[model samples]
Target chain A: GIQVEQSPPDLILQEGANSTLRCNFSDSVNNLQWFHQNPWGQLINLFYIPSGTKQNGRLSATTVATERYSLLYISSSQTTDSGVYFCAVENIDQAGTALIFGKGTTLSVSS
Target chain B: DTAVSQTPKYLVTQMGNDKSIKCEQNLGHDTMYWYKQDSKKFLKIMFSYNNKELIINETVPNRFSPKSPDKAHLNLHINSLELGDSAVYFCASSQVNPANTGELFFGEGSRLTVL
Candidate 1:
């Protein structure tokens, strides 16, 4: 089994601020995705970046597969973005079958 | 359209009861999975099925059984549940391909409580 670690287990920010969350894996991965779980407990896919970078609205993510790390950036964060952010990866050996998730970074955005 | 949907979004039962959660994916993905999110918000894979066949089975207890009748459906059945079994269960589906990042689309999650 591969290990996935997320930094800054908890975060709090005022609305309109910016922040970055990080995820590190213990091995190489063929599939990597970032997800945001809203207050209503709905999991929304943010990015599917096994490598390279991707951006969507105020959310963006970059995965440096060779370094075994990925970063998620939130620009001008909003109250609706206050929730848990998760990074999950599938080991190359698994053949992109299953995903191993990090503990998640809990984000709280206040107005 | 709801890409991935699970029935009984919330479930509460006694310690010795048996319950089942049903999941269906209309995305037509070849692989479906069951994941458990604990109180600490740690999501772990419980089971993985590819086109109605079991593929990945974690070190979960035998009391937990997952059945996939077809490619579009995967159901989880828990027997003799205990208090420790209380957690949020998520049903997800993805297109499994080694050449691409298999992004999983998850359901709204089923919150299970054992009293």
Candidate 2:
């Protein structure tokens, strides 16, 4: 029951542009996360990276996890970075559970 | 100072109503999470409490019930409420085993509206 897929479901950048957001998982993952739901909804957790890279400022994340996929990088963006961007997974057959989300990636950073 | 604090930020019940949603974590976390954001946002993960026990229970039905009296509280009880139980409910915290390793610290969402 692990299937998280998120890509440019919708995105529109302007203010000091720079972006890349993707997450695709169908299997193997102990845990992985990246969230930012702003615009008043408030989710904000930007990256737990169950595998590799991490930055956090202008934000950055990369979790290759042997190709299961994950990448979220937003360089000079602003306007509070707009909204919605989630990618969560906790597979590996779900032991030590809960976390399976990805149906988001709706940023609109315009300045 | 609000590591994770959830409450009745909004909840409007009706249809055979029975509601309860309250979670708190001052970061002394031992693990506590319950997420459900529908209405297209779709971030789902029902219950998960680590110190007060009850470790994850997805599929979430049984009229939904999750209660953890210690380890910083985890409470969500929803009985007859319907209309798909509306949406938006998030409360999170981390740190427990194999290093739950930072990051999850959300809780500014409650917005339920069953009608």
Residue B54 lDDT (model 2): 86
Docking class of 1: high
| Candidate 1 residue runs with Cα over 4 Å from true position | B97-101
TM-score of chain B of each: 0.96, 0.33
Model 2 residue A33 CA deviation in Å: 7.1
lDDT of 1 by residue, B10-74 (tens): 99999999999999999879899999999888899999998799998999999999999999999
> How high is the DockQ of candidate 1?
0.91
For model 2 chain B, where is the 10-residue window of minimal lDDT?
Answer: B96-105
In candidate 1 the C-alpha lDDT for residue A5 amounts to: 95
Query: Fraction of true inter-chain Cα contacts (below 8 Å) kept per model?
Result: 1.00, 0.89
C-alpha RMSD (angstroms) for model 2: 14.1
The lowest-lDDT stretch of 10 consecutive residues in candidate 1 chain B is B95-104
Interface RMSD of each: 0.8, 9.5
Q: Return the TM-score for each candidate structure.
A: 0.97, 0.33
Question: What is residue B104's positional error in candidate 1, in angstroms?
Answer: 0.2
Clashing pairs in 2: none
lDDT score, residue B115, model 2?
Answer: 75
